[model samples]
Target: MVTTRQGVRLLGPGDVDAFLDLARRDPVANVFAMYRARTTRLEPRWLGGEAWGRFHDGELVAACHVGANLVPIESREEDARAFGERALARGRSVSTIVGPTEAVREFWRTVSDSWGRPRDLRWNQPHLVIDGPPTAAPDPGVRRTMRAELDELYPACVAMYTEEVGVSPEVGGRNDLYRTRVAQLVSRGWSFARFDAGRLVFKAEVACATDDAAQIQGVWVPPDRRGEGLAVAGMAAVVELVRAEIAPRVSLYVNEWNEPARRAYARVGFQETTTFSTIMF
Candidate 1:
């Protein structure tokens, strides 16, 4: 187990419950990290990362997931600095620094010299969540995507990814991986969409989920459907369905510049609880 002189220790299977409990402390904010922990608990090989924790008098105070993505949860400056040193020592394995805005920013400050400037720094993402039902009227059409509709939903999924991430899901030659992901979500009833007259109009996915919360991602509406209230209504349906069948709470992070989406989420009863930042390499 990797350990620092200051008592930041790498956690393993034996610490699964504590790791997940730390994540559950802020269920909405830690949904992604909690998802990772739960998955690791069930199948350790699936985590493909190292989890580290900082303790104060034997109580876990902070946690971090370092691998393809570096995510710090409820971390202090000391935790960030220690994680930064460990991550840097392992070389540039992390492709992104993503989590609570302040923690990620502080971690970046410590690792910048070794990690280099990022390709993009998204410093302002509002993390919003809704526990109860949405205020907006739900669209009956927004339901789980079926395997038969995979062919039709692929393009919309690609469009959303390209627009949001600035790169197409098909960037690395074939889109086999992306295709598999969409198909899996559909099969698991995690992909939700509105198909009007057989055309995919709105789409969203429960990207990650644990017992307490679920993180929604890839929310989208076709260009022609923009400003038509499709996103607001469709998402209300998505939220309702997710809450009923998946988790009690649903959360998503939106770019601060996306006013339309911000308003849409607001209409659905989502309120910002925290800010998140992403440093993409």
Candidate 2:
């Protein structure tokens, strides 16, 4: 039997170990890397401040992440229901329980049936892992350089996030939460940029990384720079730097509908491992 509660707390690292012991895992290479990262160092980022979790007989079994709806759970109907209730109580407003294929379907069928949100069971995401070597060579004219200071990096980072998500990075207009978030990421070493013709033209961030694998995210290029292989050059440079510093197994995520991005990742030598789904609400 599974018991769920609102604002539930667990001794993160220990409970995460319990949850990982509860079931079979995501087959995607990137998923495992991210999960391992979270279990070790990324826990504070996802579980800080009044988050949620599920337990069976006082043992942690599953959990729902607070800010980002990246629910990492072992499959169990009772556990799924309990976690869903806690998420709803926390105003998670989502219709997903992503696991392996069958588990994903069951989560959607049971948890969201009467919740009023239309469930999209087929929601899929493709993840790629960098293992041995890069598939495509860097563009000949492409150049890469890292910005040393947050002030030097903020403009490019902000522009890339805005362009990709179609929303501007939060700056002090009224409440400074959004602006502060961008600043926090840079302070934590999460930003990167590339330039051409003296113009800072491309940007991406290391969403999560360890000494071995760095997940590349928010890769964006202005429209005028598209098709010129700037992405190949810029991204290759990022991978090279990270690999030199840590591990060579780089990874990234892309939406299934994002064909252009899929192509770009392929050019960067990423082969998909598995699909994942997420709900914004």
Candidate 3:
């Protein structure tokens, strides 16, 4: 008979494989965590925070990525509660707590009082994914963004971020960091957009990826172009390019209150697989 040693501990580089194996249990849903794990390789210096794991029988079962964003991976209510306790003790260092709905809720319940009130609580974000070809016709004009077009794209990005997050990315003097992030995505050929007569119309970027999936972020259509089917066709084009080069599956999450955005994604053949929640500071 084998005895199980159950506890939560801070994971390190040596735990990378175990962490990844746990994440792959639901690749599309866990894409963000997996991407961070792969990129940072469980190094605290690179992670800028820490990764915590819950174990049973000396085997990893659930993990949490604690950084600027607190993301729980395959965590049950109990696991999330425990992670939340740890987070509370460490103090609220993250700007956001996001992940599967139940886990995020449980985690938040654990830390909410100590963490203080968040700027926003998004409790019903639909987590959507697409594997096969997009249903809508791809827009021929929608293509990878060129580095030279950064000047054109930067404004739209700022607009989108400010609208979605309720604050300018430049707040707290993060203008350079945010701009550099946009450029990095463009340099990696992950930014996509459609422009008309030198005016940017639609745009999005693959925020992160793993061998199995990629998560799209910053999806936006200029206010003037919102009802012109630009987003549907533009996203279709992005799906084609992303599937052809990045990962086989594409995923994204949208706020439940945004019915128009939700409908557009549905038309593009994305189906909601789960719900996610975010508590943003």
User: Considering every candidate listed, which one attains the maximal lDDT?
Assistant: 3
Model 2 Cα RMSD, 1 decimal? 5.1
For candidate 3, write residues 96-175 as lDDT tens digits.
99999999999998988898989999999999999999999999999999999999999999999999999999999999
Q: Model 2 misses residue 124 by how many Å?
A: 2.5
lDDT score at residue 246, model 2, on the 0-100 scale: 47
What ranking emerges by TM-score with the best candidate at the front?
Answer: 3, 1, 2
Best by TM-score: 3
Q: Kindly indicate the candidate among 1 and 3 with the higher lDDT.
A: 3
True lDDT of residue 52, candidate 2: 45
Tens-digit lDDT string for candidate 2 (70-115): 4545545565555555545555444234443433554455555445
Off by over 4 Å in 2: 1-46, 50-61, 68-70, 74-79, 93-122, 139-153, 171-180, 183-189
Tens digits of per-residue lDDT for model 1, 164-227? 9887879867599889989999998999998989999999999999888999999999998799
In candidate 2, the residue pairs with backbone N, CA or C atoms under 3 Å apart (3 or more residues apart, or in different chains) clash, namely 125-276, 211-247, 212-247
Query: Each prediction's TM-score against the native?
Result: 0.95, 0.70, 0.97
Mark the regions of model 3 whose C-alpha exceeds 4 Å error after superposition. 1-6
What does candidate 1 score on TM? 0.95
- Candidate 3 TM-score to native: 0.97
